[model samples]
Target: MHYLLPARLDLQAHLSAWPPTEVPQFHPDALVRLLHLVTEVPAHNRKLAKQIRQQGGYVPLSAQLLQSIERHYNHYLTYAVRSGLLETDGRWWPTTAQVAGKCRGYRFTAAYCTPHPDASSDEVARQPRLQLVHLTDPKMQAKARRQGRRPTLLSPAERRDLRLREQPHAPLLEWLAPNRTPLRLDQAAALAYLAERFDMLPPVVAPRPKWPEWRPKWLKALDRDYYASPVEQYNQRLHSIVRLANRQLQPSIDTTVGRLHTTLTNMSSELRPFVYADGYGPLVSIDLVNSQPYLANLLWNPAFYTKSSSVKSTINFQNFRQSEIYKGRNVKGIIKEIPDIMLVNISQLTHREDIRLFSSFTGSGQFYELLLNAFRQRDVTLTTRKEVKELVFQVLFTRNGYYSPYKALFCLLFPTVDHIFRLLKQQDHTLLPRLLQALEAYLFLHVISRRVARTWPQVPLFTVHDSLVVPQEYAGQVEQIVREELRQATGIEPTLKHEQWSQAVRHDLLPPTSVASSIELNKKNR
Candidate 1:
């Protein structure tokens, strides 16, 4: 909620000259709020202090953000520029205009600005050096606007926004974790570790021109976004891990799918290696292989559709319409009207040979490798497990009409499975992902997490999606429980991978090893 302002700006004196009649949004408090929108980094994140040193003293605001801020008060930005708070490139785009490249926006006038291609070094240095001032007063925040309209009268977006902003965090479900005790962690020790790592990190630098040819190892596994710059990503990761280690933010679970989200989940996977839990050094995670595809494979089992079957209630599609995923999806009425048609389709597809093959591939964790080999046989360009894994998700979860060469290849390979997938999402594309996630959460959170907690009361438990992260000493025992429970429930012998949190590289990239292998390695070393 805090904002950034120029250190030299005399805010009280400046606001005293502006009469309420002449300027409304420029009132001292509102002006700071306006700056909040322009400042992309959070004040609580001290990474900004380092970012300022690395990326020159000024931070650039994108055109889209500037436009969003302008929507609130059109004249505020102009006032800031006139008052020597901000500097712009003198280019403006209409809301409807589609700029060919990234749209540039205003930056806070900094004491030492990065030299631009168009400006001389001396000119950039001579530009009045300004220091960023952190504004921390909660009184400066905009008061919540109360819409006098009834809940039924509000627009869907407004209601959703209101709910998200106002909703209080609820307790974890007993079925998921009977132990309602707070998660134990040595916060001071974790913070000390994180601070030391932060201090050791080199200054953040923009990627070189040949960045795509070769980049830092940490950059490899990151989800690619063309819109975000590398420098931005690095700074954000630094900020997130710092917040998490210090426990400034807490862990919470989503009620709809029973998925737990915490500070650990929010940070980059590459940074997770350095993090410890409950003072347990060098943790490891037991991850279900191809979790989504494996979950989807369960739907092919006829037992999954039977109410008497133990698995049915856990991932019952009958309850999906009531879930939050379909709140505004407009599929409830269609599902209600055609429940029989859905059952018929499921019954017919359950015993197909293609489905059996699909189930086999996913269950054994050979699905990605199978696809990669197939692509290679067909002389297609896909060469790695990661490439095929991405393609599998696109085929399974993307809209029915979305066309890609990989999707076409997948449909041709398993026409029956593809048809069943399309049929499941005919009413709503979201239904398929929701159903899969529900099953995953049930297996990991409810069955695996609950059992692990009861079996090893002293071992700290953490679930991140389809993985169970625990102390290295207990990884083998927990892995056995996870494997046994999943086999008993689904009748599939799932492939489980062990990832040591101490390793800089992902377990998949490293030589394949089990918790058993890790234990043996530790024994040999000892």
Candidate 2:
């Protein structure tokens, strides 16, 4: 186990980059890498490192490598101890047997699952090394197929056998949920519906309040309030952070504002000509065009009417209103309904506890109810970043996002409060709707073929605000469906951000090329 690493590393290149005279006696980065390698490589020694060395096995460990390993031993060994993977003996020692055992197990498991039968039950039972307790029925290889690795017992159904889809263990994913729900609050109805949540919904990140120290005005105003020792001096530190956060918010707003406008334009017109009217007949005056009748022709005249939403979809002037056909999914549910308003709450916490409950008017149980109702009522989709990933974003945002000078509203605010306020103000105003759409697409992908649905399917035409500019292929029917779903999802009529957006493309914000081509959708795109 004390084997020296077979060093295939470029000793000359390292020397040239950092001449030994200018460099420390040992290379810190190299030492660090060696430490990490020795720490994670079970049953590892310098010789084992040599085995993993990419060089054609020609080189032996060098003084520099040995020096680095020696210098960084403590750091590496400490990490190894915490990882439960190595032991410290003035050098990080990998569990050589553990590494080999796991790999051998995996190999045997893999070999067993291969098409060719390697052994019978009687033969496997005789091999003491092959533990067959969890996987007795050799022929029923569902687990093996699902895992697609080890030959286990009865094959599970395809739906239940998504064994390969699990994400690796990450500490942040460990959010505390009393049951299946994330931390939330509840009040006995009789105690008071007119309590904390009544004033405003509890913050999504708020922990229970410590009301005694530098109490919030609202809490003090309560005729009857409870006492808890709050950390008030920390308010100064939080306020300072908020000021810094404001400085950072302006640039993001500027960046996102441009994207919002760009997407809007693409939805309205610029991308239109590329996708639509590839060979559709030339447009003359609609009044004049109405005189002709065929598969496509306008019958009613007095056109260019903005008053009628139906006219835009028509194959000809008279048939616009009749064009829409397909209904959007999820815009309505069978038994429940809810409004479109997005609710947001953010509270700064003094204690980062394991049980971090975000108080709620209705407990998290109500979240299920709300979701069921929403699911049952409409066919709209929603989007969210992975919880751990989102929390990381939150931390970043808290540090440098959404707190700024132009955002004078958040002055003297806590980072958490400002962070929430800005998320609702900027993102909820525009991105929330889009995020909802992303959520729907994600669910569709999960329920359908995760990879296939994610990469290929879902005809997302294009989007502007909550409205999407679908292809003219669905040309006549797309608008009607969007309108229908918009009504059901947001309780508001949705309009196509653009029409004939493809035909007219100009960034100078010039007037429409001609009166005939000046569609409304084209107008918003510019």
Candidate 3:
């Protein structure tokens, strides 16, 4: 069915044209490369054309690559269309850029283009086939290979230990998986509703704030590659949301694997708000305050840890008591009587000199600020509070432990992280990272997922590790549920924080008779 017919279509032969004129002859590989580049950015076709024209150095296209691209772009599109690899509505690529007319653009029918496997192996292949040939420059390929071979800082033993915990707990994974039949159907309906009204939705606001000049070098480097520009990142997120919505609306899960190929969990924070529930309003995110730190408080508490044989049971007990906050007088009395038990236990275990300061710092409900203050007190010359906080987390989460770049600065400035690391080492030298992952899994499976299933089954929910997102109207109820569920699961009451889109933003995005307005109108009518 392919239309581009030639007796022998040699991609290499057309790489360079004989007489370098304004219009360059097109090569199939060059066209494929152009498509791949445009697909990566997906902002504008002309912009991508411009980039290809201006590109220099190794693997530079024929001198007239831009002219060639513009001339034969339609031919390439026709080939892609005939090959069943792309679909477009004949509009310029839909982007957040405030350009006048629709720019011509195309989206991939699959995440990646590859040959279809035989029927025997078809069940294992989740991604659909694309006819386009994959192209990569030799230099870029070498660079990628070099990056892949770069030595990890982790010791051999630590690497082996991490591999054991890499596959999440089976029970946890099963619990987190979307319902096989019904959820798939519901997700489909919800996705369709959202997609139909997508244009009406408010433009996604830029979620990240301006970075300070003194941001951590590591953080800046990471962002430089993947998220060079916040606006571009925001645009990519918007596209991802639409793509996810499309996939979820259809059933894309692998029954044999019992997992979805696409999930809402990986979506950026900014896009979560746009995930509309079938009949509900916009989602409001509710999160546990200092979730990991709070869990650490319970895990390392001297009174609880010493008395309890099972860590899981102790966590359950804590959560149970937390659920009873303000409801049960006995629970309240117990908390009032031993309010500082967690703080005291952690302080003693860490051998921190300032127990009162630590308690006050934890009580202030600003975990990162506590790290910043501790670092400042130690005369660390960090450029910003954010830097200190990021440095501390980088140290704590690093599997390579002290080998991490931020280790020295963090260990010297904040004793708490060092204490936690040392304590985990005493338990088992290779257990620190695994323990952290396990704790996170426990919170997600036992606390958040369970609570959502039991209490808010009717309300659509999405998670971002420690936080939960639900409709804005249900924020108060969901907050209380989260607090109680966490208390029941961990025996500690954690402060919660929430953010919502403004009513104006919501109104602009949502239909006039959307759930938000309908609920308000109904209340007024009553």
Candidate with the larger lDDT of 2 and 3: 3
Off by over 4 Å in 2: 1-272, 277-402, 409-477, 501-526
Model 3 lDDT tens row, 63-153: 2433433456556656554554454445443435685443444444433322122113322111121122333556544433343233222
Which is the better candidate, 1 or 3, if ranked by lDDT? 1
Q: Order the candidates by TM-score, highest first.
A: 1, 3, 2
Candidates 1 and 2, the one with greater TM-score: 1
Question: Candidate 2 — worst ten consecutive residues by lDDT sum?
Answer: 286-295
> lDDT: which candidate is best?
1
lDDT of model 2 at position 235: 19
TM agreement with the true structure for every prediction: 0.57, 0.20, 0.47
RMSD of 1: 11.5
Q: Candidate 1, residues 95-185: lDDT per residue as tens digits?
A: 5556444233456665423333223232231112122333344443223111101122224674574454212112122212312322233
Error of 1 at 469 (Å): 1.2
Clashes of 2: 40
Number of the candidate with higher TM-score, 1 or 3 = 1
lDDT of 2 by residue, 53-145 (tens): 222111222334444345554443344234332222221233485562211100111112221122222212110011101222343323222
Could you tell me the lDDT of residue 160 within candidate 2?
A: 43
